[model samples]
Target: MARTLAEKVWDQHLVRKGEGQEPDLLYIDLHLVHEVTSPQAFDGLRLAGRPVRRPDLTLATEDHNVPTLDVLAPIADPVSRTQVETLRKNCAEFGVRLYPMNHAEQGIVHVVGPQLGLTQPGTTVVCGDSHTSTHGAFGAMAFGIGTSEVEHVLATQTLPLKRFKTMAINVTSKDGRLRPGVTSKDVVLAIIAQIGTGGGQGYVLEYRGNVIENLSMEARMTICNMSIEAGARAGMIAPDETTFAYLKGRDHAPQGAQWDEAVEAWRELRTDDEAVFDAEVDVDGDALTPFVTWGTNPGQGLPLGENVPDPEAIVDENERVAAENALAYMGLEAGQPLRSVKVDTVFVGSCTNGRIEDLRATAEVLNGRKVADGVRMLVVPGSMRVRFQAEEEGLDKVFTDAGAEWRSAGCSMCLGMNPDQLAPGERSASTSNRNFEGRQGKGGRTHLVSPLVAAATAVRGTLSSPEDLV
Candidate 1:
């Protein structure tokens, strides 16, 4: 039978089939944990007197609440400190491997998994964080689970899941490649804008065609990372040369003869030519310009040249109501030019765009420019290893020389779990994923953009692109 890429991976990991209406039992190859969500789960296991079924497959990290500025100092917030300490105790007692704060491999769970080569093709990956969809960039069947589900996986290394309907999102560039200044981030925002936040509900979206195939692995990861924002259960790309090349020699990746065997198996993980999807959408990648969110949700986005949308212009009553609320919270008026919007902050880090390639792109734009007066820019790497690589390549120097503050790795400012956040009513051009109200801080307005756009906005003190600064 012809099968989609998702179906192929799902079948490979299926441990048992469900009888009519019951969910199938899928074996999880990796279960990633973080400080915020695992505490209750660990307690559940203790209460039930169940030992972790597979400690080697479960990995934990201290993120979400770790301070980006002081790695070794006692965390100033008592609640955050307790959470981190609890995770340490749980991991020690359970024999699960943890990349704790200040450890060389410490970082966001999603980022660390991929960096350590633990995420691989044709595998099942899960985490308590919604952004766990990021692992699908490797052609894995990856998604987020709830705390109860986390405990279930801890005890059994398996999950009961209903199969998701498949959606094919085909992206093609008119000129055969994306235009300069247009990035994978822009493409994803464009997709979300085309299909509202609920469009991908109950579906696994497979990104394919010329444009997606051509993106670098890191860029592909940026696309999949935000799949949850569009309400997709997960997003995936087929494993190919780019995927193989990225995993080639990473620490946990298969090696020597095993590597060759793994590649042979992964090469067949694509959709068959006759495969049919439950739904399909095509995006014109070459027509895309730099995009930014104008309202609260990611779906409330427009191209840089456009003006803020008027709620009255929306035909759908539900959508119009949402637009009105978003504009009020964002302190934006209908018909205002998006490019004219000024920003007090610019953040360039998150699992969505905190890789070394993202920093390199930002640094290239800030090479000889200065940040605009009064605009505070923070550049946080996604992981210590990513930070070390950026410094080795002198990218950190470029950011600091341009007046942006260089910070360590963590989920800083992305969800405002730590010190890096905006004050009330402060607006920012951020490279992070979500722009929901209070996502960065209480009453803070966030405009999601690419790293190139984030760097340019810092220099121009407004939502902008490298082309605008030039």
Candidate 2:
């Protein structure tokens, strides 16, 4: 039977199908966890006198609650400290591998997994973190689950899930070229804007078309990382030569002729040219620009040089109220030019855009420039592996020299589980996902932009595009 990559992976992991009553049971290949969500699950396991079914398949890390600054000390916030401490004790008690803070291997869950080659193609991966879809860049079926579901996976190494419809996003280039300055972030923002936030509901979006195939692994990750925000269970790109090459000889990737066999299987994990989809969306690569989220949700966004929408212009009163409130809280005047907005801080690191390529791009802009006065900019690598690679190429020095604070790899300010946070009423240009009120901290206003915009904003002290800086 013909199958999309998502279907192929899904079928391979099926353990059993209920008698026309519920969903199929899926054997999970990898289970990722973080400190913030695992404590309750661990306690549940203890209460039930259950042991983790496959400790080898499960791994945990302390990203959310770990302090980015002063990592050597016990965390100052008691609640944060407890979260981190509980994770440490649970991992030890459960025999699951853990990468604690300040450990060279520690960082964001999504960042650390791929860096360690733990994310392989044609597998089912689950995490307590929403960005688990980031692993779908490797052609895996990955998604986030809630705490109870996290416990279910830890106890059984499998999950019962209803089937999802399939969506194919075909992105083609008119002249066989990616429009200049049109990045992966722009591509996804355009996808969400076109489909609306709920477009991918009950579906797994598989990216197709020449543009998707041509994107680098890092770029592919940037696209899939936001699948959740688009209301997709997960998002994936087919595994091909690029996928195999990226995984070859990585620390956890398959090796020897096993590697060769893995490649063959991954190569087959693509949509049969004739396979059907529940729906399809097409995007012209030439039409995209550096995107920025204008309101709270990822769906409320616009291109650079655009003006904020006036609430009165919004047709839906509900939407109008939301827009007005988002603008008011962000301290952005409605209908004002987005480019004219100033940023108090700029952060360039997260599972979304904190890879070596992201760092290199930010460093490119910062190479010969300095951060604008009073702009507290930070450059955090998504993983220890990224940190080493960046430092090897002197990208770290470039950022620090440009006045951005360089920190060890971790989730950092992406979700502010750590010491990296925004003060009340502080506005920041961030490369991470989610811009909800208090996402970074109380009264923290977030503008979701690309790494290019983040670096440029840091340099200019305002929301900007790289072209404007040039």
Q: What are the lDDT figures for the candidates, one per model?
A: 0.94, 0.88
> Which regions of candidate 2 are displaced past 4 Å?
none
Candidate 2 has what TM-score? 0.98
TM-score, candidate 1, is 0.99
lDDT (tens digit, per residue) of candidate 1 on 58-163: 9999989999997789999999999999999999999999999889999988889999999999999999989999999999989999999999999999999999
What does the lDDT come to for candidate 2?
0.88
Give candidate 1's whole-model lDDT.
0.94
Looking at candidate 1, the ten consecutive residues that score lowest on lDDT are: 173-182
Candidate 1's clash total is 0
Q: Candidates' TM-scores?
A: 0.99, 0.98
Q: Top model by TM-score, which number?
A: 1
Cα RMSD for predicted model 2: 1.2
How many backbone collisions does model 2 have?
0
